[model samples]
Every structure is written in C-alpha cells, then in structure tokens.
Target: MELRLGISTCPNDTFIFMPIIHNFVDTSPFTFRVVLDDVEKLNGFAVKGILDVVKVSYGVVPKVKNKYNILKSGGALGYNCGPVVVSSGIFTVDELKGGKIAIPGENTTAFMIFKYFFGEDFDFIPMRFDKIITAVEEGKADAGILIHEGRFVYSNHGLNLLADLGELWEKKQSAPIPLGAILLTDKLKKEAKLLNNIIKSSIKFSRNNFEIVKPFVYRYTQQLDDDVIKKHIELFVNEYSLDVTPV
Candidate 1:
C-alpha cells in the first residue's frame, strides 16, 4: 500500500527522511507519497486526519490521539534542544506575564512549553516559526518563542534570549524534552513495527551517506548557512530520533 506521509522541511527532518523518500532504503511493505511542510502545518493536517503518517508536535498527540498512534521512531527529543523565548530587549520571566508574545503555533510543542512556563496570562500571536524572530525584532511582539533553526540563529536577528525552555524543563522534570514525533494512524497500526524499522534504516543510511543527503537538506532549508544546517541535523537527529525512549 502507498501511504500518505507528511513531514517538516527542517534540516533534521529532511536529513533523516531523505533516504526513505528517495528510495535509498527498502520500503518493502509500503511506499510513500510525501508532503513536506512546516511542522505546525503538519500538525494541522493531523487534526484534519488527512495523512496516514506524519511528524507532529508531541503536544498535538492528545488532540489527535483517536486518529493517530505515536510511532517509536523518527522524533526530535533531547537535552538542551527545546524552544527558546527571545525578545528585542531584556525582559524577565515575571515581566513577560501579560505581555504580547509570538509563538510558532498553538498546537506546537514550543507553544505548550511556553504555556507550561508562563500559564495562560500572555497575549499570544501564532505565526510561522521562521517569522517569530523577525516579529520580535521588529517589535511586532514583545517576545517570541522559537523552535528549530530559529533557536540557532536568533542572535543574528538581534534578539535577546529570555529563557531556554528546554533547560527549564530539564531542571524541573529531569527528563528529555519531547519536541516533534512520528505519528501513524490506526489504519497503519499493523505495519507499525515494519514502518519503524524502515525509518530507523533510513536515518542510518543518511548518517552513513551524509554527502548524499546534504543537497536535499540544503534545498529545503531555504539556503541557510551550511554550518547552521549541519548543526541542526547534529542537534536533532540523535538516538531519541531513532527510537522513542521514556521522556
């Protein structure tokens, strides 16, 4: 069967999925029709039950639990790798209360973390993840919660770090932060193990053949700096991505 697959265009996602999408791995039991979009868009697709398999924020799991099952492979989870809150000027966490903040999406893990840290007291404007830094820099919002490559390059946009949500979570929960996850709908449940292995194989293939997947990563990254792209892949595609361990 050919499954409808959805994933983000981020470097870590592109790097791990390049081999599978390009037929470098043996996708024996199933073939994929892929759709690449921003991670938040993928979450919205999940809510609509539009894809057979997708990468979505873990925060979206509860809302779409009936439509999808969390896959054990192909996720972004780790230490010091969570979302960051940034602003054009210095602001304390206490001062951020009731202030305007730009978040990637209401359904994103980043947004969930922000809520966990600050509660429902802030004015949140949901925008594209790539736009949050600029939104803060331009004073459109008092601050922005950044995910993916935004965390890496926020300083270049002249943004100041307000808090590292990942570090905060780690300190409080003493667990790895769960960012994005691979979710397979119930229709694909029987093939879950097989699909998981295929995803694992794909990530392994990409790591061993980095040069082969580099161009694909670059293509979706909007021509980001080569070093930044490499750093993104290194930071996100780790053991947690290969298998979902307890968080």
Candidate 2:
C-alpha cells in the first residue's frame, strides 16, 4: 500500500526519514510518497486530514486527535529543545507585553507554549517559521518565536532571546518539551504499530549509516553548514525519536 507521508524540511525530520526515503530499510507492502514542507503547513494538512501520515506540532494534537492516532516513534520531544523568543533589541519579559510578536503558526507547539509562557496579552503575527528571525531583524516585529534551526542561529542575526519556552515548560511542568509528533490517520489505525516500527527502524538505520544520510540532509538544508546540520539532528533526534517516553 502506498501512503502519503508529510514532514518538515528540518534536519531532524530529514535525518530520521533519510533511510526510508532512500529505501535503506525493510518497508514491505508499504511505500511512502513524502510531502516535505514546513511544520505549520504540515499542521494545516493534519487539521484537514488529507495525509495518511504526518509530522505535526504537538500543539495540534487536540485538533487532529479525532482524525489521527499519534505514533510513539519518529517524534521530536526532549529537554532544552523548545522554541525561543528573540528580538533585535533587548526587551525585558514584562516589556514584551502588548508588543507585536511574529510566530511560526497559530497552531504550532511554539505558539501554544508561548501563550502559556507570556500570557495572552500580546499581538501575535503568524508567519512561516523561517521568516520570523528576518522579520524581527527588519523591525517588522518586536520579537519572534524561533523554532527548528532558528533556535540555534537567531543570535547570528543579532537577535536577543527573550525567553526559552522549553526551559520555562520544564521548570513549570517538570517534564520534557514535546515539539512534534508523527500521526497516522484513523483509516490506518490497525497499522499504527507496523508504521511505528518502520519509523523506528528508519531512525536506527540513519544513526548506523549517518555517512549515507548526511548528504541527504545537507541537500535539503544547503544554507546550514555541516556543524549546524549535525547539531540540529543531535539536539532534536534523541532517545525520544525512537519513542515518546521521556528518558
């Protein structure tokens, strides 16, 4: 059976799925036609229930729970791996109140935690995650929430971090931050275990054969250097990538 699989272009997603994309694993009776896009777009797709499988912000779970069953493997959840709020100018957390902020998406986990962290008093401008840092730098926004590689590179753009949402969540909730998760539509509910295993195997294959996977990752994110790409994968794809249970 063929499945429509949706994922982001982020390094962790690319790294985990490289083996599956390159046919380096045993995926009998199943072939994935992957749709690579931003996490917000994937979240929109999940809300619409268009894909057989997808990676989406964990914040979208409440919206798509009726449509999909979340799988344990192939997810991004860990400590110190959450979105960061950044700005070109220094602003105290209180000063950011009522200021205009650029966000990845209204439905993203980042936005959810952002609201929980800063309260619901700020004006949120929803945009593509990749454009947030630039928007902040250009004075289009008072601050922006940075996810994926943005969490690492925002300082390079002369942005100051106002808050690390992950740290806030950990301190307040005392748990790892859940950034994203893999979901399988209810039509394939019976196959959730099989699909989860396939995803876990793909992650394991990529780890053991990283040389073969690195070029694929670099190809998709050519703007990021080797170290950034590696760091992105190392930070996001951890013990949780194989299963959602916190270690």
Which structure among the candidates has the greatest lDDT?
1
State candidate 1's TM-score.
0.97
lDDT of 2: 0.89
Global lDDT scores for all candidate models: 0.90, 0.89
Clashing pairs in 2: none
Compose the digit string of candidate 1's lDDT tens values, residues 1-247. Answer: 8999999999989998999999999998788999999889999999999999999999999999999998889999999889999888766767888889999899999999888887989899998888887788788999999899888888888888889999999999998999999999987798899999999999999999999998999888853798888878888998899888655
Q: RMSD of each candidate?
A: 1.2, 1.2
Q: List TM-score per model, in order.
A: 0.97, 0.97
Residue 208 lDDT, candidate 1, scale 0-100: 95
